[model samples]
Target chain A: MVTINKPATKLNEPSKPQKSSSPSLTAFVKAFKNSIVLIVFILLWELAPQLGFVEKTFLPPFSEVVQAWWELLVTGELWRHFEASILRSLFGFLLALALAIPLGLIIGWYPLARDLLTPILELFRNTAALALLPVFILILGIGEVSKISIVLFACTWPVLLNTISAVKNVDPLLIKSARSMNISSFKLFYKVILPASVPTIFTGIRMAGTGAILVLIAAEMIGAKAGLGYFITYSQYNFLIPEMYAGIITISLLGLLINYGLSSAERYFSRWKQ
Target chain B: MDKIKFERVTKKFLVRDEYKKGAQREFTAIKDIEFSVKEGEFITLVGPSGCGKSTLLDLLTGLTQPTKGRILIDGREITGPGLDRGIVFQQYALFPWKTARGNIEFGLEAKGIPKSERKEKAEYYLDLVGLKNFADRYPHELSGGMKQRVAIARSLAFNPDVLLMDEPFAALDAQTRETLQTELLRIWKKTGKTIIFITHGIDEAVYLGERVVVLSANPGTVKKIVDIPLKDRLEDADIKSNPAFINARREVWNLLHEPEFQGAHI
Candidate 1:
């Protein structure tokens, strides 16, 4: 049967190959050229306030933010907040992965499950996870439970929807080919359907990873004593502009690290795609 | 007993009537399709588009049940797809995740063969298809011809007595197609499997088949079965251009077009 649904992302097509190889020096030069814009942007960020293009107190110089970041690291304050955020996001993400995948597979594969759950899923799918924050807070209280639950809620839909579509959209020809071998349904699911669904499922996983971080940060900002989000907002309230900038920078770096980790994992799983 | 049998089989699909609102109709794909194949014979089914050649194959593979009759293998009615028959599709449905050798091992694994023996068998068939060096390459890494070769090896690895090929070489370029055709004939001779090959091309049908079963389109049924008289056609390099090969090709082509011409007159 033909399944119609949008993919979470464009399938990860391999990038085109380089036309020719070059010396190590040339490769280093090319790498430098690629980073030119980023270097210029960083230079401008440092210069903008120093040259009075912006108010120094409101938007501190890049050097001051770096100094503040260094102090946070030295005092171990940043590590505490970082650890708390990481724990919440990781727990929520892992929890969502555990629940959503099997649920998605059932909904995708069996008509009974799909028919029963689809309407309720549609209602919840349309409702934003953040919008349910008050309900979560009201029910689970203003502790770790509410924050983690919100992150879990946010992460679940992307993983669930993408996985359902992934399993549904496996090439019918491959299924037919496997079926002709008189393979058991169990063998067919794992051998053909599961492997075929991996690339797309990983797409969902990566999206969930991003969502986990974003939601946990937001939840922390709304109410939390120790987290990057709390640290940033609290720093801003106390008129510690450089410390706030440091918190924001830390968050960006954390996002980058998370993205890099997930991308590497995706590449490892889909090595055969090359 | 015949190696495979199709006893007055018919298939119909329940389809939504596009021009009418909320209406359904039965679309008959093939009707009363009676045929039987002898052991160790290469039979090619040739037809125009919508001839239900594929439907016939689906029934034979037991992927779909016949709406009207029974299909049997070894004189026993087919319950469902089994290990006795293997199928190769034109699209080269090799799992992209599995390497060429892994794809071949899939069926053996389904048969619950031990890992070491499955690997040995996969390698043997990979060698048979002239893809020994490409055992570890995935389907996307291989060229079109190479992918099809791997698909053929995958189907053959399990050692099914009946091999059903649905235009397995149809997607290749002319040069590649002819090369694969020659290679297929060579493999058929080596394996001595009861082969049911399907194609829309007359030349392919005539070139490969010991006998060609021509099917007419629109409620497809067997129109005629023609035997090739050339004894050494497989060994003859110039057989396609040979007078006898041309005559047989012409005969199958005429059989395919006869219904169309009759419809035009009416």
Candidate 2:
């Protein structure tokens, strides 16, 4: 059966060709073009305080923030906090991935499992993860466990839902064609279903990666002592504005790094899709 | 002996009527389809849309069960899909994750063939389809016709006794379709495998088939089986202008244009 009745003309069109230039140089130019707005914003931030558009003590100059960031980096204080935050988010994200993917596969593959679990999933998905912070803290104690649990809770929904949808919606024709070859069920799942679902699953994974960091920061701000969130809060209370700015900058850079890494990994896995 | 047999096969689907409060109703997709395909014969199933041409192929592949009767391959009643029959879909269902060679190797992999042997076999089929140099290319990197060629190679690599195709060239442009049709005839002549090709194109059916099985719609059943007299003219450069080709095409076109089959045009 022709389940997807899209016109042949649409399918026949070739994907837009990539620029035929030296790869590294082309990538560098592309990156520079993409970051033009960010570069201008940074330049403006540096000039704003230098030109006395804002008080140095209140907002701090970009150079001062960088100096504070460098001092923290040299003393290994910033590294500790950065490392701590990374480890927690990574651990939580990994745990959620481990639990959700297989479970999503099961739910997607079997209609009964989907029916049994969908209501509970939908309920948890709609309820904000932060709103459950106090409950998590009370149940798991105000420690790394609660912070990690919060991150796990925040990341699980997107991964699970996206995986379910992806697995459920694998092109029926692909499966039909495979079945025509008498492929075993196990082989079909691995060879056909799993690869077909990877692109959508990666979308979920990227979202969960970002969500893990966002929720972890919020969780850290509540009770943690050595995370970027805690560091910024502590600096703000002590009127160390430059240190606060440094923490914010570190978070932004960390976010950018995580996103870049995930995208690269996504590209590697989905090279076939292109 | 017949290589494939459909023994009074019928398919019925219970489709829900949305306007009638979701009432379930029986839709007879095809009724009492009885035909036999001889070994090494190239047969074309020509009909309008909804005539169960695809459903017949599905039954032969054992992807869908015949609700009423049995389908047999080589005197054995087929229970489910086996390695004996390979199908090429119009959509060119090559695995997006696999290269041309890899897609061709898929059936071999399922049959538990050794990796090295699978590679050699894939290469052989790639060359047969004139895509030997494109074996390493992904499906997306190839043009529409090339992709379909890879799909044909993939089915052929398995070395099945029968090749079932469902409008395999309906998606291609006219030139590509004609080229593939000629290539298909070459492959059929070389391999001597039984081919049951389905198409809505009357001219294609007349050009490719020794016998064109014309199916009628609305509880689809055999309408007319037109035996083309111009089988030797398949390779003619001006075959479309040949009187015999024109006669066969007109004959099939008239059968399809019969009053009951009017609205069934694709």
Q: What is the lDDT of residue A80 in candidate 1?
A: 99
Worst 10 residues of 2 chain A by lDDT: A1-10
Candidate 2 stretches greater than 4 Å from native: A1-35, B263-266
Worst 10 residues of 2 chain B by lDDT: B228-237
DockQ of 2: 0.58
Docking class of 2: medium
Show the colliding residue pairs in model 2: none
Give candidate 2's error at residue B158 in angstroms: 0.9
DockQ values of all predictions = 0.58, 0.58
Query: How much is A8 displaced in model 1, in angstroms?
Result: 31
Q: Under the 3 Å rule for N, CA and C atoms, how many clashes does model 2 have?
A: 0
Q: Which ten residues in a row have the lowest lDDT in candidate 1 chain A?
A: A3-12
Report how far residue B192 has shifted in candidate 2, in Å: 0.5
